[model samples]
Target: MAFSKLELFHSLILVLSVVSVQALTWTTTPFNPPAIPLAVRSPYLSAWLAQGAGAALNDVWPTFWTGSVVGWAGFVKVDGKAYSFLGAPNVPGAAFTKATQKSSQFTSTQSIFVLSAGPIDLTITFISPVEPTDLVKQSTPFAYMAVSAASTDGSPHSVQVYSDISAEWVSGDNSLTANWSTTTGNVLTHQVQLATQAVFTENNDHIQYGSAFYSTTNTVGATYQTGADVTVRAQFINNGRLPNTQDTNFRAVSNNWPVFGLAHDLGSVTSSTAPVVFSVGHLRDPAIKYIVAGGATQARSSYFWSQFSSPAALITSFLGDYANALSRARAFDSKVNIDASKISADYASVVALSIRQAMGATEITISKNSDGSFNKNDIIMFMKEISSDGNVNTVDVIFPAWPVLLYTNPALGKYLLEGLFRYQATGQYPNKWSVHDLGSSYPNALGHNDGRDEAMPVEESGNMIIMALSYAQKTGDNSHLTQYSALLDQWTQFLIEDSLIPANQISTDYFAGSLANQTNLAIKGIIGIKAMSQIAQRLGDTSKSANYSSIAASYVSQWQTLAASSSGKHVTLSYGNSASWGLTYNLYADKLLKLNLFPASVYEMQTAWYKTVAQPFGIPLDTRHTYTKSDWEIWTAGIVTDTATRDLFISSVKKWASDGLSTQPFGDWYETTNGQPEGFRARPVVGGHLALLVL
Candidate 1:
């Protein structure tokens, strides 16, 4: 974690100066929300910055907010006033790419700018103090650029500001340079001021030693004049990385992350108005901590803004609603503190982060067919499909989404189920089995891009049947069962007739590799029968219920015989190997979902699994892989009544979700071995974040 003296100084100066400038006088409008406390530790500071930029805007700095950790002091500006500029965050995977100037590490940023601020002058200044870190560690001189004027012509102006390293290389002063020019119009000039190390470290608190350069570039012979109400754009570009284009752009000059401006545009200006003057300042002050901390709000706001539209909006909105519900559930957990093990603070954050994280991996779509039967686009399940590269409706992906939707809003579950039902009922395929995922994440129900159907019939059928019944029970509504009775009949019949589960097909862990996984099949058959019975009961069809119940009873007995273990344990594997089953089979029986069809001892198997083989972060999904799934763990927990055991499950998931200061969107998977994020981000399965609601 330690860096060379020179490197340390460079980073310290960068973070402190970057953070301090924005913290001091950061302001938006209406009212300035409180800044994050400055005294927090560095790791937490990164988390806060991640959270601020990831969350939505209106939620925090309604008018404006921006958080960033540059090479120098971090900067957070909210409502036009700079808040805090602390030392920069440590980018662990920092590696210089020949193609890029900045390290390969991701730069997390968020901002809030006045989309329609009346004509006004805006300027920002930054300073750095040398107390928290060492002098050598805080001496990495930096350059910056603040927007002068951004008018909305055919092409709005882009303000480019960076440390004029060339100046330092030539003049040895590290003076900065600024460039601002509209696509068309008038021009304004400004000068740079570098704070001396002494002034930066001592008295010159507001503006000190690092050098600054000014630009006089102006757009000429423009179509629009100064009198027009042109949209004003406050832009910030992180040019530290080469291919400067790699650096994300914040549309406005506020503190909120980039997402906040997704729905709002920078304000326009008129010829009568003076050029928009953006103050460019830097500081190495201690107060930068608050601004750095505000990054969380900025993150949350940015995430909300980015995912708040049509294709991604539905999933994002659902995830947000679910996260809120999980928060509520966390509150409810306290009402009956006795069930502490059922949920916890860690669990709450996991679920909340899920909404904030996943749900961005897929695209939503709908298609009109020639037969007048509208076909809904299948939600693409993976970001990268071996067959489709990065396509949608992979059946495997839908499997994870069930727990998430089931926990929060059953209506969405129903919508998803109905889509599956449509495909099962009319798919071009011959079998009556539930179809695998319908399509890629982007093209919508366009068609399965994976090039194959569900090879694992029982697993998918079980998922569908169980989800239907679970939805009914959870929502206290049987209308869907009645409406889709025909499809239900078809699926139930398929389970009874051919769903003993065929050999060789994919399950949730297709990525880990596949097999004829009998334990997986047992779960499928047992759950499928249970769902059929539940559906019958809900529909008030006594005969059907009794029939399905009888069939399910028989299947349970068969399952027990086939999957039972030496110590009367429930362990099922296609190969009958205890070791492999112990690794692959979640031995945790869904006793609750099955209405206690099996003994609590079944759930105990999972508890044993957690106790014996679980890693510091999570239990492995199977023997073949060192990774685990957060969603499955929750689903397994939902079936358990032991609050303590369930809480443990929640803890494992939270550990992965919050592991590392990973601010790269919300990842749905994590490495069970090291507890680091594995794959996928911003996916809808984050609805699973509400798994705690099942309590």
Candidate 2:
């Protein structure tokens, strides 16, 4: 007796699901990684595996999320045969063994892979212990790579493994004049600093130009520069310090991961089955030496480092309970994992890989008052600085990232809102149509960046009010609401006056350029006003609530009249214009918020139309083009109860991640037809993928 094909496939799926929940590991697409997110601690100390698979680790360079090369150290040895794992190919040495990636697995906080290198089987794992709830460790700039090697035939073998870091960690361009020195105190420390102390002076999409320090514990023989290129190489042998053996670089090319730089010693074992651990840590200091109203300076960087435990201490703490950390990641990832898994592995993969990288993009910053006090204000006011524009605490950025933060660590969400409120309380952000676009461009928080730039108009105003409602709904922490009531009132009035018919202006998709009569932006304003009314009711302002509620209801009525399609297929991009169309993604928020703003058919009709316009990568952002926003597409799909239509959108995302525009970090924007990313990668806004769970 045999089961049907469908039944057998279902069983396989079930088994895979169980394994997935137990271990968050999956294979990569061999040579192409679509960019593996490695160390995602903050905007500064972040790295990605951009190298193609099967290529020598040195052949490819590891980069920060900003696309800046940090350097490579692909040196691994098994039974004296050199193998490459982290850097390019082995430096033309004898008994070279090609290490092939067998499979890749990841938890929210780690990436693990099994490599096949001839007779020697190696399991390599990189762990970055980042727990959003733990502020100290969450922002700690450290990661660990653990390696386990054994022989297939149960033979005694002596093996060595090592890591070499690049000097690019210290400057934007490796050729820049750098001061290199080694400090040996409690541990072996190597430091790199540019000639000028230029910190937080620029706010572009490039990596920071500042100081960097790399260190290792219980390791011997480290190099700051072996050739023309700058590199930090350390060798540790047999779980102890390496013997007096240095990498003899016969081929010292400008760009090479030389086996000669420094060899890491992996302790010898009598049997084939032996395990050893080694770690590398990085510290990135950002900002000017003095305080700036825009926030984040050299003083703050040093202060945070002061509170942080040493790298050896932090790594020991991280690796000691490493299994538990992965377990926690499995559980946290399970929130989106289970839901997306119900769709397919493709869906689950996208969601699982995104959870940590998305959340880590927004660097967590804590400040203390002059009295050496740490309050809610001090607890947060982070830069929110992980985008191309390098914007800080912008309303739109907050809007997409809200759901996850609200659900996972609502306290952080509350803290974020307080930052916004503090800025608004200064009477700096104008609420006529919208507040400022950003507090200041990345790393700064002196004043609103919108003062120098064009206003987002309805975009910012609507986002602020709606995010406030979301914060309250998710966390039930309304104390901040009370604190921000006055500013809320001002913003609510702005919504009432212009929300019904927003002036031609920009949205969070400001990069796409401004648009007038934006139907979706109008939907944003409507939901915002309704949300404010709900908050007003919660605060016991019945009269004000009723007034605003009536105003929002009227706006909805008029919008539907002007924007609805006679065919009941989809809403137009603007009022009374059937030819132009856009994603009414914001309309789905009404369903989630239970505003009862639209009929059920409205959703069915819009979704039906969206499917028709869907490109291979995803449903287009609108009829404007085939380019789509990854988060908005997910949010729109999340409105549904089942995984039917929702799975299609998730599948599109899976295709994008697998073969998107480039093997770079995840961004909010991408070409829907070809998966070519336009802008905004590795942004925290992908946190919005939790929309369905929060709903």
Candidate 3:
């Protein structure tokens, strides 16, 4: 049938409309998480969209993980009519029609949103590349926001896209005066920073000493402006482009609300138009302050500093590597989805949501050379024990978070442990057992020289030994074990003495308070002894290995009698409390390391017991409370022999995640019955959710 060009265009528009209606349906699976990850790369670069009922991107502002607003806004002009797609709510002179969000979905490394603005459909993707094997890219601390617009009505239209970030991203305290400037080279950058830099300090979990960069490629039709938020956005709204001017009025962030804006003009847009990409990052030179082996505090820079000459070069490289970065991220997301879905779709969704939150808590750093360069070989990764306590490189925290690192890249686990090993090897810590954490406060890796760190003797020592061996087992690298042999032996000795009958102490679930003869704590110590046996065998100390093996065997035989309930149904929370049961997640290490320390009957018994006592969300941490830790639940699920039992545990947690009980980040601690967050949110412990895949 021959038709006129106008008739053909109308027919194509009808077909596209039908397809768009089907594609626009939201697929928020497992369910819509309480908060969606936005630009979550490192701890300081982290941002999230707090989810509310029917929450669209245009209406709600993105916030830091600490719940402080990080003023980022996006707008688009189609045929000279402005529409809001991301943040800015009320501009005095510019009244923008809010775009209708069509659909949203999150994967392991990206959050994607589709919105309709007039005749165009905009696809916004937030990509925080998780390059585990590529330290240079992974340590860059930059996240990408790529926006693409296409004609939804099968007709061409003039389009211009605008995005801006306020000075509030530089300092948490809005009253602090901010300074900003624009630079043009390979990339156009708007750098905003606090006037007064306070190194190694944080205002409400926001790094107070870094410059925040909002940058884009220096392509044709790209323009930039920095000024009062209203003035800058109003100009873009009125003219469909920025003025390419920088405001010299440096003032408090809250005074005039300064914003750095960039705009791109696409003269005519169709379905085949390319995406415009923007990069946002925070950079702090000498990112951490650490006490060295000789008890002298030294400044450490992020590993990216070793690769690039300056922050500008680093950002330029990151901007240039967008295509490769997105490819790698998509590959990673696909692998996570395929592997996790083999268990259940619910498991896949939970695992997808947890990757960024887990990796976001860590920073890889290196020592600065005397010549002002960086020494890359002296590298260590530090993690903030976030939300619960701001401790640095906490042993127990890493123990739970280690599974994800092991599943992704074993080398990361080694980097996390290196700082702790260096601190203890220097004899700075006086504790007979392993130190609890590198420092009580974050960004300051000061050793607990006073020996006043929280006492989790059996817990921390066991966690250290198990994690060290787990890293070696996964990577077939034992140099770390050989180098730290003395400290390992010392911790093994402490475990041998106190493992069987643990004294009154706290486990990682310290909020539940201390208890004597904790069955779970004792089993972890027993497993640590067995793990040390393997470590000794790998190091060629067969005599020590045999002796440790014999001791571990004897302890397990006695542990079976002392820890089991009289009904033989499950292990008790403590040695003699028959009526009190808990998730014996420590058993996962035995399975993970291929150590047959416990019999198959023990696994079956515990799996069956979990089914009987399961809560609406999942199993509780213990009989003492109705609250559960998601990390431990997944660890327990990973070790269960029954497929249905494992799925039950996975599906239950998925139910809680979709329940919208808390709008904070993916929390590890929550009440099992109602799925309410129990204080802890956005902690790296959710990395333990990767347990099923790790096995």
Candidate 4:
């Protein structure tokens, strides 16, 4: 396969960009990311700056992951001259000049952009804290944007910073009537929401029930306003401050375009000036509707509700903790970078870019009491299988995302798996194999009581057992396994029957279409049986352990012969097809769990074979397509023993991260040949990028 002229041009640009930025000290290398995450905290609170052409911050409006505009705009008034620093189609009559973006870099939890506005240099940092262990801080739906300005000419400049959120942030539909008001206390909050709330529903991935909060500390020189976008922005643009007035006439989002604005009047700005910080978030009570054991629905509140009395309290604490949060986030970035760089610099870039998107898809929730308080003890971290399907707690999805969860905090891996186990333990899913996902749609964990969920019998069963053991292995806690022993046993029994040669069924790569005797699927089932043996051993069931071990070993021997190609070079995609070949990423679980189900030669063979089939961006998912799943590619990379082969996989993905054509969030699925996004984006499966880190 020859590289297209466009691909060659992107490659040249990638090389030049790296060369040009080498002299500048940055937390991470500057790359043209598919999209720059702005305030991506939860599914509903997610927003990003789509990177296209020059990838300039001021060129386009920030959009929700679904590509709808979520009107977040920022401007800096330097000596009464307004300049748009964040979003585009500059507010009319503001006479806004687009700020020149100097550089852009993203750490694990923050995206930093440096821009020039006249004599002042503005550093805008978007911080979405990733507190994996601290449920309280992590559960807070808020994300922060801090703008610090200093005179590049070494002279003091009077500067006033302004920012706003339009009513478009409230609901996806622009025609919906938006009701908004201002709350003034220690903090000034402009709250906007749909006039008629549609609870437990969504429009274009925007939750229709929540209130969007745009807030800042109520400082002496601060003012607020709620009115038409042009009216409020022009007010600040001309007077260097807002009117501090609220628009009482609630109207449609498209009607004059209502906006919530805040302005900070920094009299004299120099390097010594304090940074202006803003907090933006969405508040959704009864976050998830979950079904308990008795088929009764229960509303779950965000875990932050347990710590903070109300939305105000949570927002206040989050706003005040910016310094500490930024410190922690920087430390996390350093640790991840240093650790991942030990593998390769290319590998570090891949891991660094994926951390936020991987963790952002989740929400930590707890059951609420009758009096509206949350039950902190009964917590579950629910994941929205974003982009592809909005299913809550998808097993295969969790399997791919488990590496980061396990590496960050093993308890999180347990928390993710707990929801799946709890749902199945209720005897609602009548399938002998593991259920595909908790719910058909997100925020609704109503079990498939009718047992009509999509079936991936061998695939999901293997994922559950592997993830269950991986969590227990990392945390040294087998309590979950012991607690869900019966279900595990049932799934293992199903695997035992299907382990040797899988019947015609879909694997996790269901997009590739179904095939009988899939080589990768068979191996997963075989490894799952081995994992169940370990579980039985941990439980002191010596007879059960021996039985499973013998079955798994016998099945592996048969799988090796049947799945291997006639040339004995690499495994085929399915049994008995010499021309068929695929990623065989399932092999990573065997190595990860220390199962040693396959010999050393098998790893060496696959590693060598991958190099031959590698494309410019990545190895293809299979012979059927030119595309590949980034998560699976990383997993395959982690299983290889040789450094060259591992680096080959890592660098290819890093190249794609920098050059991929899709102007959305980081996509997990893309064309291996041209780095164009095929389908999926912003999915937690990018957590699989941490496979090398996990190793």
lDDT of 3 at 677: 81
Per-model clash counts, in order, read 145, 27, 0, 0
Model 4: CA > 4 A from native: 1-28, 369-372
Q: Model 1, range 438-512, lDDT digits (tens) per residue?
A: 543222243432336546566667777777777778778876678778777877787787545446666656665
Runs of candidate 2 with Cα error greater than 4 angstroms are 1-33, 51-59, 89-97, 181-188, 202-210, 219-264, 270-281, 284-306, 309-327, 330-336, 342-344, 371-377, 381-387, 430-434, 640-642
TM-score of each: 0.52, 0.85, 0.95, 0.96
Give the Cα lDDT of each candidate.
Answer: 0.39, 0.62, 0.88, 0.87
Greater TM-score among 1 and 3 belongs to 3
- What TM-score would you give candidate 3 relative to the actual structure? 0.95
Model 1 scores what on Cα lDDT? 0.39
lDDT of 4 by residue, 459-550 (tens): 99999999999888887899998999999999999998886788999988889898898988988999999999999999999999999999
Judged by lDDT against the true structure, how good is candidate 4? Answer: 0.87
Candidate achieving the largest lDDT: 3
Candidate 3 segments whose C-alpha is farther than 4 A from its true place: 1-26
